[model samples]
Target chain A: MAFAEFDLIDTYFSQRMEQRDDVELGIGDDGAVVTVDAGNQLVVVTDTMVAGVHFDQDTPARAIGHKVVAVNLSDLAAMGAEPTWISLALTLPSIDQDWLQGFTHGLREICEYYGCQLIGGDTTQGPLAVTVTAHGVLPHGSAIKRTGAKPGDWLYVTGTLGDAGLALAARQRRQQVSDAHYRRITDRLYFPSPRVALGQSLRGVASSAIDVSDGLLADLRHILKGSRVGAKISLDELPLSLALTETLTQDQALAYALTSGDDYELCFTVPESQRGVFDTLVAHTASKPVCIGRITNEAEALQLTLQGEPWQLPETNTGYEHFASPIEPSV
Target chain B: MAFAEFDLIDTYFSQRMEQRDDVELGIGDDGAVVTVDAGNQLVVVTDTMVAGVHFDQDTPARAIGHKVVAVNLSDLAAMGAEPTWISLALTLPSIDQDWLQGFTHGLREICEYYGCQLIGGDTTQGPLAVTVTAHGVLPHGSAIKRTGAKPGDWLYVTGTLGDAGLALAARQRRQQVSDAHYRRITDRLYFPSPRVALGQSLRGVASSAIDVSDGLLADLRHILKGSRVGAKISLDELPLSLALTETLTQDQALAYALTSGDDYELCFTVPESQRGVFDTLVAHTASKPVCIGRITNEAEALQLTLQGEPWQLPETNTGYEHFASPIEPSV
Candidate 1:
């Protein structure tokens, strides 16, 4: 029998979420009900990944599912919030049982790893797109924000950058990489993990933070605009994976790191006094962040240097613009 | 200049939502932070309406915008929760400044009317679709659910049925109607009002509740299945709008009322003792509910009667099933 909406939900999403005491009532109702703990506030974020527009049409269903959750969870991570619950609005052209199984498996894996519950959602028939809304909680007044960065603060970003961009470039035949490098680059593009631990750990340590989904230049510019500060970065300090560097020239790697998108890593700023402590705190983590620059007092412009000399970016290389830029494959 | 994602949001969604104290941080942040008032639980629901599948390709952008919010709000009403905040993930083929204006105008009007804030959202480029995730609040233990009905309760439905269904039939040229009737029926299809006040009033008075989206029979069947009971509905007691009755034959109207979807009215039940008070509570509303039947102990079947005679519906009439049903224009 062809699965109806309800049946599909039952087979895929309904029973897999872990039990949570705060979720008083869950799926199967018109709405899900939960209680927010006394001293914590709720954090809400949403992101939609449209097939063909957000990823390749031939991408694995599991990868699409993982990317959707990871991008939204990355937003929560940027806020220094603990993910608690999520709801999905999935639209599809038709039902493919194999695709559904792979999708659910990926979704379930992320929910389990994050200790988040899938509360409720809607499944509809249409163009394929997955919109995920993630809810997280943080102590009142403790969540980090982009507007908190201050002049003179040190800038840090978790994990290596540009691997996902390199993967995309290679996929589009705009660049090439060896097979060994191709696997690592594609893995980063397809299954980039959200920096949840790093963000949670930065609660009282970072002055401001954001996740790099629109490349380093674009996302850091958002922090500068919001915090009313500028930033000075040394191009040589940008963290690039060995796989990325081995596949392209230094300039090409730098271009990808600076202008390409979909690296779901937390980019944050910390006061000079907190630098030592923050470094030590993140030292043992799998994706320890590295300092690359300092927040500056120049109200609206980003300053750049390469090996002590002034460096200027091409005017068109300012990262992805959803409306102005052509659709590019990314997590 | 072409509208970028950020510019479109700023021009339409950001400054329109009413400021609320509970919203510690609103739009422009990676995630919004809000507090769920103490003593009340949080209710969350999500719905997505795709272009062409949910409505006509040429439907008014304003109406498209209104229906998305209205449908999601109906879910909140069915839970007897007061809406507090909403987040939207809007995907579009491209940005049209005029359409964005009209759409946001419709969204803002509803948000202002219902006191819900558009806290945050993501705008992406793709085939057109709107996904809204609404959050509401209710007293700790007062949320109405489909599982609470009993064998002796009275079944009631708010507002008239069949109008939206008739509208869809006419749109597809399966039925004919006069111009005046066309206006009325299409209005219902495009802009059905959510029974927010009635749902809130039904809090302690209702035994079980569900919003009638997938026709009277289909939605009531959900309650019956959930409550582990059956219902004996009087076919003749169904409330039909004058426009619906004038547009089609009596049998057609009845069939539409029973099998057609998109009538976003509340179908609920109340215990025998609460009937009198419940009637008084809803007496002054714009769409007063009428008693149509009584709940029964027949575990999993729905009984039907028309003017004291047992009636059997044709085998083909059930209701909308996302994958099985044809696309119909609906609010």
Candidate 2:
């Protein structure tokens, strides 16, 4: 409590980031002034994480900071925008120097990688919570939207799924895993990588896109509801991590892939005509884009199949709804 | 707790605001896409208010909602930007139908009045807090900054000061006031009007500008430090509302005017050359712009005088620092 707001910002945030030319005025101002490229439109996204709700005390402060920024940037990536600037409103119950150091370190690492500038924000004393508003820009008319999916579009997801869920299960003692596998899987939960480059490459190639934060089915529902289309996905086609597959049964792994959240991977649709182009674009990237389903004409209907046989979802079909229930540390 | 996040947004926020043309995609998207005018730059500011820290149980939910937006808009006003869009991150302990209704109603009223669109935000379950990030637009190179003041510039303020401070004093039982006076003063504390038009008008004329949210002298110190200039102000010229003057002794009112905060009025400086333009522009406005003092050659020094005699500031020179101490409801 002895740390003044100005000193806290100066010590932790102001000098930590590199300056950008687009930011006319950065921190230490009433409001930040930044220029958007002439031919680009601004994409804005905001996400908030509360200590006990979005995360728990067992979670590292560094991971908490990284996850907060990653979540917001994931939304920007879903819109196929290049990250540019971020403003963070951080509230803390008390100031712990070690916690502050770790948190800012995680924040700076992601920001440096994405080439985004920390413009300005507010810091207050209260229960721990972080609200980040990220700003990005894309060429005018190039933003991929949830409403743009077509009935004949093919569904694709970048990277593997269910690793975060598997990590959560192991941590909560619902499942046991080898030490090495636990480390790798827990990293997936703590340090989700926003598909920035993949999203940028998907702009014209993909018809519609969204990030897998609210589980694959729930997020796909958004695309279907907006585009007024249906989807039929193959369970066998789901990309699963080695750790997830090794730790859980086939059904449980598939269930986690289908219903659990916080993957932060890109789920998108590509028209059949552009399938080759999409394949060529993602061919060199580290993310393995896998085709899992196809859009259908039936509005708002989702069909699941396993090796050509009909399949059904688990009873807990509801995805992450903030106010519906408390979010346990394990997803 | 039964209300889903989507329902919470749709029922209270989605349909309430008028659609804006510049907002290409609004709520119900992974991210909101907005267009900044070709020749304009973006001004961004974020502010967070915590329940017990920023307000108390007695504070109305409507006032909380209004003040959050007002505070951010006040920052944009300081930058001489035209308010455009807002994103809110709201955390609540639990669902209260009446509180939500009043809060959203207040939010809608302010956004409608300011011509700002609510693009998107996150609603979560946690301790009660609200963080609002406001976006605005200004013509290229037109932003007025605190670093622009020069020695010999004249200092001026928009409207009266010390009203909010007096209201806080009355509410905390530190001062006594008539019922009518209390109502008038507390209204100042609850629903502060950001001087948007006045700020826009001063874009070219004012050398430096800042919103007085941390008392007059503390905010003025920012201008002085940034601009590397000093200032000499007349205590007799400090404008006090009739409600403030009627409730406290002259010295007590001056102390509040100098040290108390949450006024949201603009304190700015104008070089002698542009003084005529500033006076002429503000002549027709409701806010009576008053000249308080002049900038001095000494760097980072502030001098006070009353009727041409040197004066001393109150012992409590330190201003509001969020983490330095708790923000009582009255403040």
Candidate 3:
């Protein structure tokens, strides 16, 4: 007989989300059992990826699984929560054993690395889609919120930005570029690393922080809005890959860097007085966070300066949205 | 301008999942916040409903939303936990203004009834699908499990069965039945009252329990498999509705009660002495649970008897398996 949905779940989706001390019971029951620290609070977020929307039909199964799980983990990182468990709702048009095996392997790889367990979830037959809800725990009153920034808090971002956007733009054939540029851009697009440890390290050090999910300009503005602060972004300070610079003009590259999203990097604010210690803290990690701008008390307006000359970018709000449009419509 | 996904989120989904004391910060940022309660463990579960697979495409949007959330909440009820919050991931083919309004209204009605705040969720464009991830808290050592039943425990089910299965059978024909029968069966199918409070009350009382999303026979077998026990269900004692028995013969109705699935009732095992208390508890609630069988210390087998005459109800494993045969295919 062909594989039934029952067999598919038993064969693959039945494995534990992960094995953690907090998880009293894993998969195979009505729900999952988890023990949170005595004074810790739980952190939760949900994301849905629909085929033909978030991902095309032909995207590698491994990449789709990795991206879905990684994106949610990135949310927990922003909240300074230690990952604990995840529940997955998989909707498939049909039972594809090979696709499921690859998906599970990638999921297992990430869950094991994050010390989170697979809790309880359901699988059903429908149009291909994957919805993941990841849960984590944070010490009571210890989480970093977006509204904690103050004037004079120096802004920093971990690693690069525009690369993912450029990578996406190049893949869409928006404009022609050299093979080297195309390769670098697409690679970034396919595998944007989440800055988990860096976020955890910024627990008390960074006054305000949020993940760079939307392009830097829009996402950073969230911190500014939440903290009732404004910021001046030094366009010249944006980090660019050599290949990216070779493919597009400096201004064009800067546009993608400022506005293209999907980078899962941390854009945070640390007090200027703590700058010396912050620099020392970064020495322990290979992924160095770069200083980009400073938070200000001025009314909410984001200014960009290039070599002391002012530049204006489009005001269109971007990044992922979940209402009229599905998420990652162009992914 | 098109209804940008972000604007739609801001106008609707942003606050669909609410923030509570347990939730540090609500939506509109990188992620949401939920603090773990001290000494209480968190139970997580998710269920997805596709428009045509789980529910008819023409099903009322309000009821559809309510049922999707209720079905997931049923998982928590099976675990005997008090649901506190939920996140929804909805994938839609397109934006229908009235549908959105009705969907949210239904979602909010049930969420308020259960005291579960909507925390955060995502929306995507795809076939009509809705997934809900619900979280609940139980005392550290008190979460009821599905593997604790002993052979000598009594087999019991909460409320009536077969009504939902029959309702679907009728709905497929779109034939109108008596108002009373319609009220009774439609409630069974659409407004399944999950035994959350009842399940919680049985925490220390029930040996093992599972919500009857599948048929009672199929669900009870889950307990049997997990606890390594067998069961003898007294078919005559099964709870059936007058409306159900009117159109179908007693045997056919009994078979539907035993194997047609989708009742969303609770089937469980408890010591014989707890029967009086269980009955007493049901007398106080609108929904009444019924005792139908006894557990046996044998290898996995399910036997049904009528009027003291033993009959073999060989297991067909008739719970609605995702992607099983074409029978319970995704809506």
Candidate 4:
């Protein structure tokens, strides 16, 4: 027999998804509310994850839960907003108590780490999917936007990329990988740490920014489009992790890093004059920021290169899209 | 080939889910916002629908789109909120333009009619499920809750019930019915008008209230538990549609009416001394309210009677739940 609503909620989610702190009301309430910083404007974002589209069915529940919330928070981080509250709409094929518990446990862990509160949400029987609406706040006019970048801005990213894509490939192919490498890749896929502090620090500093949920090229194109400018990107400067270099050739690793999605590390632009200041800020903080390219005044379009040779990349976007199906596996 | 993200959004939802005055941004943006009356506190609710669970694949896409938002708005209506804005997240199997167009078209119609706006949401590829988060506002402290009922408060419901249940039965049995009756019954399942005006009108006047999404018995049990009271409900007073009464015996109709869910009407309690005022208010409204029973301060339980004899409704709620199997016929 399928689990009842009360049982599934109580056993899997009730304990894991309830509010903590002076947030007043929590789960079981029709609506939940908690006070935000009185001086800040609230920022809200929503994202949804669908089974087989967002993640394969073989994906672990906890990872799926963590990744869903992580991606949404990544939006807030990119906007330089402080994460505050979230609500979820979880739909499942059947009452899989174990899966629900795993999902909520991962979600709770992330929320607790990020100082976010779970306010409220709706649950219904459906094809497996999870939609999370997250709330954040930043001082009025302080939130970062893509339209802020200008000519001569230095483009940068935090940490390496493509480990997630490699991990996905390995998993899909059932390849035997070193446990350490597999762990590294899965961590990249599942637990993308939103650069919250780094973003908050960039508010008055960075010209414009966005998280790299899409491939670097696609996302940077968004910045270029929004800012009405062009860019001179250096493929050689693309940050590759030790894991990425160890497992693949430089060209292959560079290809994957340039186009891999799901790496929630931020890609931002700072005025060239502030480059020294940004370097100092990164030096002062635990998180390191890497300057990879520069924004240009010319509007000819993005020019990707390695040592000045024109670079080639995939014609389509990486990972899932709301409108389209996955690219046919080339491997 | 899978669809592209922009194409997916445009083909499925974009034109159909157009912007309204209340919307500061819509589908194309990172997030969306709707302004609320500063004097009124916001009431928010979310609900999800899955293709095989909450609805069948054969179900009209327009109905699915409309019902997704309608259910959440029903909660706000139960709270006496003025419907204002909504955000939607949809996951799909493959991008199907026709389905999306129909769905969004239906959704926009409701938004226009209810004076609400589409704010923002995320679209990702996945299995078929839709999640909608709706926001509304009501005068601070005037939004009725389910815990305020006291002894001697009269139980009332707006409109009739059980028609949707009969309609479902008819559909399953392939029974033909008159067009007018069919429209009325199907409307219960599809276009549930959230009692926003009536709920807002009853703001301080009604003692407590809830939306009749679950059967009256189960929903009343929720209020009784919250208020620490019992209720003596008269089955005879249950308002039944003429079509339902004409088709089924009183007992069968009463059973469906009492236990059937999906009646998106308001069920509330008002003090007896305010009967004249309540009556005046109801008589002036489009959805006429009917007295069904009285609240009694006692051990928590709900007792229903036809001519003062006992009647047992469904002990467990079977209306809808998250992560449960899809309704059998739908599957």
Candidate 5:
């Protein structure tokens, strides 16, 4: 059977996700009409994933769908906004019914979990790729920016890191792991949980915030540059998953935790006055927020310490550059 | 020199567009935060264009950038919304300086003309493609929908049609045209004008509205199906450009006008009771609205007439299908 564009959308996308009262018009219109509450502001973020560049052919279609939404949602989480709606622009080399089924299922699963509705989008024939533009909402003055940190702030991060990097290394045959550990590590790489609730909880508490998509050191640099402050982090304070610690040495695990990307955990800063309140509030959350360092008055300076001695960064301190040579799965 | 993602965005996009008060945070952030007035609703639209599918290698980069923004704005125009902000998710095979210069120049030109600002977006390395999600705003209850047409509503279309189809045919060597006319028609295809002002003026007047991106007959069918009302259109009444009329026979021109896509004009319906007011309101507009049809009580039936006699549709009545085999240049 030939599936035309409209039929494909009707079969897989329309009427599949939950509808919200704010969506006056959803699919099947030239554009969608939605309302933002009286005192709320709209937050918009977009992310794109390509076939060979972002994922390998062996990656499941469901994982691709989930990752595209997850990455965009992670950005929203960084902004301390609640995900509300998403528009997907999907491109495919050909029509594959099974792939479409799995992709839509994954998309629906995450959107429903986040209470976001699939508003509308475009479907085209091209290289396999998907671009998701997510819409979020928050109170008018509650947005947490990267430029809000100050000297004497306490730096923190949610959840552990380095598992995703170790997972990719295993998948590429650079490392070996047992089946059970491999499953745990790969699950971290595939289905990253965006810290949506934690981000919201830190809206009034965090002095500055950013999602760790490009390694802990690299992402922390953004906060330092934006806020014009410095940070001193202890490598021993870096959080690591059991899968990563068991598979690699302490030094190797620290390297991955500091330089590897694809960890969707939130890296944030809290002022000294609010540290106690932040710790108390985070104690009840699912992910235990870990304090890693403190902010300094030195502008754009990042100091690292291992044990009790000062440490040096690798010769190449760059993070994941999108156009850098020898493409690897970064996001 | 390596053009990293951050460098590319900062050099080309960050400082180019106009800054607006409504945008609390623009580029360089995880997400953009924008305000919507208390009495207004948001209109969102997304469209994607791919290389080899939307345009050939001979197409100019400037045209690609302009067309992508124009198509999304056209959808907003159909919804009777004022264009405000846009987010772009661009994927490129490689970094070409000249292409980026021309593309950003074109994008900035059109955006400045429409008073729309570029907020934030994603850039990735992949096959060449661009997805633009545009946001617009309108009064809370003034959005013109596709399901609001009623019996005795007069259908009207803005500007002319079929020139873009003829332009494509000429470019493909399937048709011949004079050098002067070729530029005129190709300009129609490349730099389509989204009827932003006219669409805004149509608020509360046009019962239903849609943009003509998938040919006239195919797009009109959407309104007919959604409104559950039939239409009677006169083929001879379809507005044709001078270039199209002089290049092809009347029958061929009418056929192109009815069946070709990428016109980017507005098709709307006004009730008979408000016809006088609509005519007076449209008389002061740039694109003179032309009456070509009237709504009927018969459900989902479209009757066509040429001169005074009943007309029949061609065997293949479908519009541009995104996943259809034998890829063609489409927006």
Candidate 6:
């Protein structure tokens, strides 16, 4: 017999969620009740991941669970908010107890690490999908926004880029790589670390910020659009992992770095006046921020250069488009 | 050529959301930023409706849209919270512009009516489903909970019961219902007006509260379990609409009222001492509640009575079980 929805929730979800003082009511209630701090504003975001689209149908439950929460948390990181609570709406084609146990274990692990409590959610029968709505809090008027960047702001990205994209390419059989490179790239794809702490530390330092999800170029376009500015990016300055450079040709690696999506790193802009403070702040952080470009007032187009020579974007070098692309398994 | 997720959101959701001052930031940002009043706690709930499961595949898109938001709003009503914002995670097979227009039209109409702004959400390509998470606010510590019921509390239900169940039976061709009865029953299923105002007024009066999504008997059992009490229900006292009573035999209607689900009505308890206050409050409300039972200290088993005689529940008379039961589209 299939597991009943009520019993499954009691067994897998309700007890697994850690308790918090701010949660007056949690799972099992009609709705969860939580209080926001008086001087803070609540930041809410929702993202849905579909099986066979966001991940392979055979992907491990643990990895799927971790990735869903991580991606939504990345949104909070972009806003420079501290995640306080999350709610998940999970739909499954059938009841697989073993899969559920592994999934919840992974979800709980990450949630506990971040001190974010799962307050409530829903479980239903359908094609497998997970929709996580994360809630975070930031001090009033202190949130980093894409609209805050000025023309002279310096663009910086945390950690390396193109690793996840390269991993996806290998998984899709579009590129060949050694076993070592495959492992490293897949690890980056399956277990991305949301730059929550880095974003939090950059609250007052970064002029504008966004998480790199739909590739460097696409997400940067969001920042540019919101701030009503353009940018000039140095192709050679784009961060690349050792595996990425070693496994693929320079041109291929550059394309993946620019257009391959699913990287959860923070791409932020720091105005010239805040550069000194930002540099100092990054020194104490876990990941060093790399300056890759500069914001510009030339709103007509974004300028790309490689070794001080103008470069034209290849026609095929485009970021993931939700409508145009098939449900690619890599992510 | 299909509509991109970006353009679809811009056309259907972003501009249509009513502006709110408390929403410092809205859709299109990394996350929505909202301010809560100092004395209020936020109530959040998420519910997912899958095609061919929550509703028939042929069900109109507008009806599906309306029901998704309505069902989530009912949770807030049960907690006496005033809905302020809603985020929708909509997964679809492909872009159908006509369907989308009707669906968003239905969503916008309700949000505008309730003054709940569409804050932020996700749109992904996948199987047809909608996961809506609603957020509301209430005075701190004033929300009604199922655990508040105690021995000697009277049970009351808002509106009628069994209409949706009967409608579902008719749709499946297991029961025959006249066209007039069909129209009324389907309407009840599609558009349930959440008792937000009544719930707000009954905040201090209700000892325990829950929305009747899984039939009267099953949902009331939740209250009994939470409060560590049992209940004695009078079958004759159940409030049934004319259509239900006229369409089904007496025993059939009784069984439906007790076990059939998706009523979206509130069932609550009021302590004996607050009877006078509750009665007075209900008199001024739009839907007069029906007193159907009383909470008892018999914690082991619930007692059922029909016309003052003991009644035994049939072994098969159980409420909807999400995993085990077939998708009965009338939800």
Q: Pick the candidate with the highest DockQ.
A: 2
Q: What is the lDDT of residue B319 in candidate 6?
A: 78
Give the deviation of candidate 2 from the true structure as CA RMSD: 1.8
Q: How many angstroms is residue B239 displaced in model 5 relative to the true structure, after the best TM-score fit?
A: 0.2
Instruction: Give the number of colliding residue pairs in candidate 3.
Output: 18
lDDT string for model 4 (B172-257, tens) is 66445677888789878777777878888888789888888766765777788878889998988999998788887777778778
Give stretches of model 6 more than 4 Å off: A326-331, B328-331
For model 6 the local lDDT of residue B166 reads 88
Q: Give a tens-digit lDDT track for model 1, residues A54-76.
A: 88776788888888999999999
CA lDDT of each prediction against the hidden true structure: 0.87, 0.89, 0.78, 0.75, 0.88, 0.87
Q: How well is each residue in A1-331 modelled by candidate 3, as lDDT tens digits? A: 3345445667886665456776788877888888888777778888887887766765678777777888888888887777778998998878777898878887877888878777768888777889999987777777778899998899888887778777666666676778877776666666556677777777778888888776787778788888999998787887777766877787777777777777878888999888888899898798798887878789577788999899766445455444434234432
Using Cα atoms, each model's DockQ against the true complex is 0.70, 0.79, 0.65, 0.50, 0.74, 0.77
Worst 10 residues of 4 chain B by lDDT: B317-326
On lDDT, the stronger of 5 and 6 is: 5
DockQ, cand. 4 = 0.50
Docking class of 5: medium
lDDT of 2 at A164: 84
Worst 10 residues of 6 chain A by lDDT: A322-331
Model 4 per-residue lDDT tens digits across residues A27-132? 5545553444334555678888777666877778888888888988888888788887788887765667688778988898888888887767877765677899
In model 2, pairs of residues that clash are none
Question: Model 5, A215-278: lDDT tens per residue?
Answer: 8888888899999999999888888888878888777778888877888999999998998898
Task: List the candidate 5 regions with Cα displacement exceeding 4 Å.
Answer: A314-317, A325-331, B314-317, B325-331
Tell me the TM-score for chain B of model 5: 0.97
Candidate 1 stretches with Cα past 4 Å from truth are A1-3, A324-331, B1-3, B328-331
| Native-to-model Cα distance after best TM-score fit, residue B234 in candidate 1, in Å | 1.1
Instruction: Give the Å shift of residue A328 in candidate 5.
Output: 6.5
User: Tens digit of lDDT per residue, candidate 1, span B123-232?
Assistant: 98877899999999999999999999999999999888888988888888888888899998899998889998888889999999998887788888889989999998
